[model samples]
Target: MPNRLRRAVAGLIAAVLLTASATTATTANAAPSSGFDNWSCKPSAAHPNPLVLLHGLGGNGPGNYSFLGPFLAAKGYCAFTLAYGQATPAIPVGGTVSIAQSSAEIQAFVQQVRQATGAAKVDIVGHSEGGFQSIYGPKVRGYAGQVGKVVALAPPTHGTEFGGLVSVGDYLGLRPLVDQVLQQFGCPACDELIVGGAAVAKLTTGPIAQPGVAYTVIASRFDALVTPHETSFIREPGVTNKYVQDTCPLDPVGHVGLAFDPTVAQLVANALDPAHASRVVCAFGPPL
Candidate 1:
C-alpha cells in the first residue's frame, strides 16, 4: 500500500481500539459512585421524589438502565428499577408479559417505593415499552397522584407500524400468526404494541396521560419501530414532546439505542429534576 494509505489504516485501527477500551471500561463500571439498589437511601429535599426506572421490550432493570441508574444517582436523585412481565413462569426474560400485568407490577413496585422512601410521590423514566407502561400504570391504576413526572424515551405511545407490518397484518387478518411469533420470542408486549391490538386499542380509547402527572416523551426521527415518527408523541395537553434530532441534529440514536445513549440519559436527568436540569451533550456511542 502507499504511505498515505498505510497511515490511514493505522489511524482507523487505533480509533477502533480506543473505542473498544472505552466500551469495556464503561460496562465494567456503569453503576453510580454513590451505589444503587440501596433500600436505605432516603430522599433529600433536592431530590424529593425517588426515580423508578422501567425497562422495555424483553429488557431487565440492570441490563437496560445500568448507565442511567448511576447517572441519576450522581445527580442527587434516588433511583430504583423493577423487573416485570417475565415471558414464562420458568424463564427470567422481562417485557414478555402482558402490558396490563406489567403495569400492575409497576403499580405494586411504585407503592413499595413510596412506602420505603416515605415520599408522597415518585418520578419515572422508561424506554420503549416501558415508556408507555410508565404512563399507563399511573393512569389506569389510579396512582396518578403518586407520580410526579414521567420521562419516556422512544416510547410507542400509539401502536407501531412495524414498518407497515401492522397495516399488512390487519388487511390480511394475521393477528394470530403475529401473536404466535411474539410468543415464540417470549414477547407478550408484542401483541399489545401491534397496530389495532387490544391493549393498544384500549390505551388509545381513553386518555394517554393522567390528570396530575407531567409527561415528557423523547424520541428519534430515525426510529423504524415506531413508524411515521409522529406516533411517539403524547398528544395529551401539557405533554412535553421532543425528537432527539431536533435537539441534536447529528444524533442518530434509534429506538433501543435511546436507553444506552448518554445524551438521552442526560435528557432523562433533566426531565426528572427540571429545577436543576443538566446540560444536553450531543455525543454518540454506546449509551453508557
Candidate 2:
C-alpha cells in the first residue's frame, strides 16, 4: 500500500483510540490530567495570552487539548484549540492538508484569539505535524512578532525518512494520489511534505526564529516516527534544546509516548513557566 493510504488507515486508528483515551481524563479524579486541567482557567497577570494546542496528523483539535489545553488553562493561561487541516469538519483527521494553508490558518486563528482576548501574544505547543503547524503562523505568516514562545514536540523540524517514501510515490507518478490524500488532512504539500520533509527545510531555509520569540524543543531518544532523532531539533539562534533520555537515561519514552507522558507534560508546563525551571529534574525512571 502507498504510505499515504497507510497513513489514512493509521489516522483512522488514532481517531478511535483518541476518542476513547482522550475523554477519560476529564473526570473528577483524573490525576491533574496533565494539560486538561486548564480549559476554562482564567488568565492571571503572569500569563496573559491564551495558550494554543496543536495536535499531530490524524488528530482533532479536542483530542489535542484533552489534557494539554486544560492543563494550561488551570495554570492560568486561557487555552484554545481548533481543528485545522481537515477537509471535512465531520472527520477532523489531519494528514492531507497543506503546510502553507495550515500556517495561514494558524495566523488567522492567532488574530482571532488576540482580538477576542485583547492579549498581546500567545504561546504555541504543537505535536507531530502540529509542531510544524504551531510554527507556521510565526515563521511563514510573520507572526513571530506577535508570538511569545513556541514549543514543538516530536516535530520534523527537518525532513525525515517518511518523506522519502513520498518521493518514491511522486517519482512513480502518484503525485495526484499523494496530494489528494494529503488534502483530506488539510495538508497541501503531501508530496513535498513527506518527500523527505521539505517544510522545515524551507522554514529554516532562511532564519529559523524571529528576534523576539523563544523556541524550545522537546525530543525523545527512541522516536520511531522522526527517525535519526536529530530531525526533531531546530538549530537556530534563539532556541533551547532538551532531550528526555539525556535526563532520564532509563526513560524509554518514544515519539507517541512523549505526547501522553506526564513527565513530558511537566517539562512542557515548566517551559511555559520558566521561573519554575528549578523543578525539572531528569529522572532515570519515574522515581524522580
TM-scores of the models, in the given order?
0.79, 0.75
Q: What is residue 126's positional error in candidate 2, in angstroms?
A: 0.7
lDDT of 1 by residue, 1-288 (tens): 366744654454345445434543443344332234556668887788888998876556755665567666767667788777765545335666688888888899998988988999999998878887887777777888999999988777788877322211211123454355455765556777877877778777777888788899999877766776788788879699998877788886666567656778788877777887767878663211
> Where does candidate 1 stray beyond 4 Å?
1-35, 163-186, 285-288
With candidate 1 superimposed using the best TM-score fit, by how many Å does residue 15's alpha carbon deviate from the native? 14
Best by lDDT: 1
Tens-digit lDDT track for model 2 on 192-267? 4453556756776777777898888898877766666787777777888888776666776656456555567778
Residue 106, model 2: Cα distance from true site in angstroms = 1.4
**Runs off by more than 4 Å, candidate 2:** 1-42, 163-189, 195-198, 281-288
Residue 144 lDDT in candidate 2: 85
